[model samples]
Target chain A: MSFPGLPRMTGWRPIATILILAGAVAATARFAFGLGATTNLSDAFPWGLWIGFDFLGIGLAASGFTIVAAVNLFHAKEYEPIVRPAILTAFIGYLLVVLVLIIDLGRPDHFWHPMVMWNPKSVMCEISWCLMLYTTVLSLEFAPIILEKFNIHAPIKWIHAISLPLMIFGVLLSTLHQSSFGSLYLIVPNRLHALWYTPLLPVLFFVSCIASGISMVILESLILSRGGRDYLPTPLRANLAKIIAVTLAVYTVVRLQDLLARGALRELTTLTYYSLAFYAELLIGFVIPFALLLVERIRTSRRGLYAASLMVVVGFAFNRMNTAITGLEQYPTQTYFPSLIEVFIMLGITAVGFSAFSFIVKHFPIFEGAAVAPGLHHTAVAAQANPGFLSPDGGDLEPS
Target chain B: MSQKKAMLIDVTLCVGCNACQGACKEENQLPPSDEKYLSLTAFTALSKYNDLYIRRMCQHCDVPTCVSVCPVGALTKMEAGPVAYDGEKCIGCRYCLQACPFHVPKYEWSSTQPRIQKCKFCASRLAQGRPPACAEACPTGATKFGDRDGLLAEAAGRISAEPTKFVPRIYGRDDVGGTSMLYISPVPFEQLGFDARLGKTPLPMLTMSALSKVPNVLSVGGVMLGGIWWITNRRSEVQAFEATEKKNRPSRHEDNP
Candidate 1:
C-alpha cells in the first residue's frame, strides 16, 4: 500500500481535529440563523469572503490540473514528483469550496434542484452542472493515487487508461466554469464599478486562476518541505518558480491591456483607492512573482522562491476580494458588509477543509517515503551506506 | 422575427411617491427586502435634477447575460417577454447575481435555499391579459408598457415633439444591444442613475467573442506539442535506421578488425 514519499501522522492529527470541530459548530450556527444573523453581507455587496475566498480562491488553487496536464499529457516527466501532491491539494481545495457554498446558500436543501429540475437559461445553473461534473472528474483523476494507496490494483489499468482523457475533459470543464464565474458578473454593467467592469472580466478570471493555481501549489510544496524536512530539491523548485514567473508576466500584461482597451483607465486617476489596489494586485501578485522567478539565482534559492510564492498567494486573495467587494462599491449608497456569523461560518469552512485534508493525507499513503521516524535522523550516519530510496511497494515511513 | 416587449419609463412625469414600488410588491407577493435586496425592491433613483423618482427595475436585456452564462437553464427569457427564473431549477450558485448588468437579479444570500429573484416584467400578468401592477398603478402615467417597436416610436415621438423637454438619446434603446425596458427623462440618464457608458454592444456578444478564442488557443497549443513529439521521435527513428544499415553494409570498422 506504500508509495515513494509519505509523511508521518503523529503531530498534525490533534490540532487538525480541534479545528474541524470548531468549524462544524460555526457551520451549524450559520445554517440555524439567517445571513444577517451570521456575517457581514449587506445590500451594497451581496458576495463577501465566501464567494471571493472559497470560490475564486479555490479556482486559482487548481493550477494542479494545468501542471499535471503539461507533465502527463505532454510527456514532461521532470514535473512528475510534484504531480501527486498538486492533485491532492486541488481536490481538497475544491471540496472546501463546496462546503463553503453549502454554508453560504440561503437554502442548502434546495441545492439539488439545479440537477433534478434543470433550467437551460441560468448561468448559475450552468456553473452548478459544470462544478458537479468537474468535481467528479477531479475525484476520478485522483483515484489512481487512492487505489495505489490501498494496493487495490484490480482496476489500476482501467483507471490509468482513463486518466489522460479525464484530464483533458477536466481542463475543458474547468475552463468553462472558471470563465462562467466572471460572466455571471457581466450582467451587472451598471452595478459593478467601471474601474473593475470590463467585458473581459471572464478572461481575466481565467488567466488569474491559472497563475494563482501554480502559485498555491508551489507554496504548499515549500511548506511541506520545511515542516516535514523532506527533500524538496532545488532543481524542482527552480522549475516551478520559472512556471510561476512566466505565467504571472503574461497575466500582468494582459490585465493592463484589458484596462486600457476598455477605456476605464480614466477612472483609475479619479478613484485613487481602486487604482492603488489595482496596481498593488498586479505588482505584488504578478509583477513581483515574475521578477523573482526571472532571476536564475533567485529561482534556485528557497527563501526567494518562498517569498515570491507568498506574495502571489496574498496578492491573489486581495484581487479576488477587490473584484467581489471593493470593485462593486461605486454606488456607496448600496454598500454590502458581511455579518458577524458570516465571517465565523467562512472561518469554520476553511478550518474544516484544512482539517479534513490533514486527516486524509495523514492516514493515507499519500506522503509515502516522506514520513520518517524521529530516531532515523540520529542514525543518518550509520545509514549512509544505504541511501533511503524506499522500495516502490514498501519502505520505512519518514517524518515530513 | 417577432416584436420585442418594452417599457417606457418617463422620469419627468414620475412623482416622488413610491406607488410603483408598493404596487410591484403587491403583485409579486414579495416581502420588503429592506436594503438587502435592492433590485427586488423596485428601487427609485433620487437625484438633484428636480428630485425625479426614477423607478429602477430589470431592463429585460435583448441578450441576457444571466441566461447565456448560466450553466443550467434556470433563468430563461420567454417569447412572451421577461426573463423568468425557476426556483426549483436554481442550484444557488450566484453566477446570475454576478452576470446581470443592471443588477436586476438579486440573490437571497441569507437563505440556504436561495432563488434568484428579479422583476419578471409580470410575464404571468402579461399572459393573463393585463399590464404590470406598477404600470397599471402609475397615477401620473409615467410608465407605459407595449410592443418594443411601439414603445421606441412613442419615445421618439415625445423627444421630437418637445425637443427641449427630453434628452436627445433614448436610454436602453441601444445600450447593451437594446433593452425591453426603455427610459425617457428630461435630464440626461447619467444624472438619473443610468450607466451611459454601457455602449451599444450586448454583454453576451462581448463574452462570446472571447469564448470563441478558446478553441483557437487549444488547437495552437496542440500543434506545438505535436511538433515537438514529431521532432524527438523522428530523430530517434533516423538513428535506429542508420545503426541497422551500418551493421548490414560493410563498414570501415569491420575492415580494420
Candidate 2:
C-alpha cells in the first residue's frame, strides 16, 4: 500500500543516493587502506571530524530526554505532541553517532569490549555505558509508534507501563554523558588552549547542550511545519524559544564567570587565532542568539526564531570542533583539515539520517492528527480526517 | 622485591647522540624510522632544544590519568612504577591519548588492528633486574635508573652540590603528582620543551571530582522526578474524581425531576 504524505520523488533523492554511494565507497577504502591513507588523523591528532561531529550530534539530540521528561515525568501534556518527534530525532542522531564511531574506531569489531570489561575510573568507560544504555532507552521510548503502526497491543501496554521510569533514567544518563564529553578534555589543560579549557568545562558543556537541544527542537518543528505538518503550535514555539533564551543567558553568565575566575580572560584579548575563534564562537553562537531570543517580538516571530536557532546550531558545532581540534593545535606541526573522504563520509551519514527520518515520518505515526492507537492504523485514519491524504498515485495532496 | 623503579635523567651531561633511540628500537623490536615524535614503532624519541637534547617518553605517572581514563583498563600503572599495556584488553578507543598530559601515547594509524604504543619504562627489563635500554646505552650517565626515592635524593644532591650548575628544581618531582621519570637540567624545564605549567596535582583528580557527583545527581534527580510525577498524577486524579461527581449529581437531579 502506498503511504500518504510521502513527498513526491524529488531531485534531492538522487543527490542523496549518489552521496550515499560515494560514502559507501569511501568507507570501503577506509577499511582497506586504513585511517592514515583516508583521513588526516594521526598520532598528533587522533580525533578529527568524526569525534567533533559526534559531540554536536549528541548535544543536539539532548532534546529527546528534555521533552520526554517534560511530557511523561512532569505531566506537561501540552508537550506530548512533540515528544515522539524529539525521540525520533534523538534515535536517528544516536544511530549516526554509533555509525561514525564504528567508522572511526581502530577496531570497530571490538566495540562490545566495554560491555564485559569494566573501568569505573574511566570517563570513557562511563560514556560507553551511557551511550549503549541511552540508545536502548531511546529505542524503547520510540517503540510505541512502531508498535501502533503495526497494530501491536500487548507490547504497547508494556511500553506505556515502563515509559515513565525509562524517561527518568534516560534523562540521568544523558546529563552524565553530555557533560562527560567536556570532561574528556579536562586532562589536557596544558594541551587545550586556555581560551577553551576550564575546570568548569563539564558544567559549561551541560548547560550549552540544553540550549542547543531546545534550539534543535524549534528548528525541527519549523521544518516540519514548512513541510505541511503543523505539529507544533505557535504558543509552544514561542515558549520553546523563551526556554532557549533563558538557558543561553545562564550558560553565558556561567561561562564568563568561570573564565574570569580562572584569570584566563586575558587570553581572549590576545591578538591570536585562538582568541579570534573564541570571540567568534561567543558572539555569533551565544551572544547574538541570546540577545535576539530574549526579545518577545523576535522570540514570537518565526523568522527571528529560525535565525537564532540556526546561529545556535552552527555555533554549538563550532564550539565542539574547537574543543576537539583547534584547541589542540598548540604543539602539532601538522595542521589538520578533514580529507575529502572524511567530509564525504560525514555528508553521506547526514543524508542517510535525513532520508530515514522522512521515510519514517511518512510511514509511521510521527505527526499529530496521525492516530497512534493499536488497530487504528495511520493511512485509514489520516485519509478520513483529511481527504487529501488519499492521493493514490503519489501526487501532491495540497497546492505547494 | 626492590622499591619502585624510576629514571633520573641529568640533562646537563646528555650529548645529542641518538644511541638511546637506537637501543630502544632494538630492545622493543620496533621498525627503524626517523620519527621525531613517539609513534607505534618508536616508543622513545629525542627532541633538540637549542643546544640540549631532551628525551621524550611516557612519564609513567604515579596516579596516571591514562590508567584512570582507559575504559577497559588496557593501560595500567604497576606498583613497580611502569605503566603497562594489555593489547587484549584495549578496545582501541584512544582516550588515553587525550588524557596524557605529556601526549605520550601513540596510535598505529596504518594498521587495521591497531594498538596504543608508548614507553612502558622498560617494564620487562625492570622485571629482569636491568635498567631500561636507553639508560643502559647512555655513555654520559645522562639517563640513570634506580629506586625512585634514591633517584630523587641523588637528583637533590647534585642540585645542592653545584648550586649554580643545574636548575634547583627536579622536573617531574611533583608535576602531575610525580612520575617514574625525573629530570635535572641546567636550563629551565620549559626551555627544554617541557610542559612546566602542569600542576603538581594529579590530572585524574580533575575528572574524578566531576564523576564523584554522578551518584548524588542520580539519586537526587530520581527522587525529585518521582516526587513531581506523584504530585502531578495526584492532581489529575483529584480533578477526574470531581468531574465524575458533578456529572453524577446533575444526572440524579434530572432523575428526581
DockQ of each: 0.26, 0.41
lDDT of 1 by residue, B1-257 (tens): 55567789887888756677777877877664333225544443223355676677777788777777665567788876788888866655566666666766776655655566778788888888788887888888888878888888899999999999988878988888878888888887887666666788877766565556556655664565456544543454455445444554465456567
Candidate 2 TM-score, true structure as reference: 0.92
RMSD of every prediction: 8.4, 7.7
- Computed on C-alpha atoms, the DockQ of candidate 2 is 0.41
Q: Please tell me which predicted candidate would have the highest lDDT against the true structure.
A: 2
CAPRI-style docking class of model 2 based on DockQ: acceptable
lDDT of 2 by residue, A126-217 (tens): 88889999999998878888877788879877766676677788999999999999988887888888878898888989999988998998
Candidate 1 residue spans exceeding 4 A from truth? A1-15, A114-126, A175-195, A199-203, A227-229, A261-271, A331-337, A369-400, B1-4, B15-26, B29-51, B106-112, B213-257
| Candidate 1 true-interface contact recovery | 0.35
Q: Please provide, for model 2 over B1-257, each residue's C-alpha lDDT reduced to its tens digit, 9 standing for 90 to 100.
A: 45888999998888878788889999998877666777777788889888888889999999998999998888888989999999888877788887788989988888888888889788888888999998999998999989999999999999999999998999988999999989999999989888778889999988888889889889998989878877876565555545545555677778679
Give each candidate's fraction of reference contacts reproduced.
0.35, 0.67
What's the residue-level lDDT of A49 in candidate 2? 90
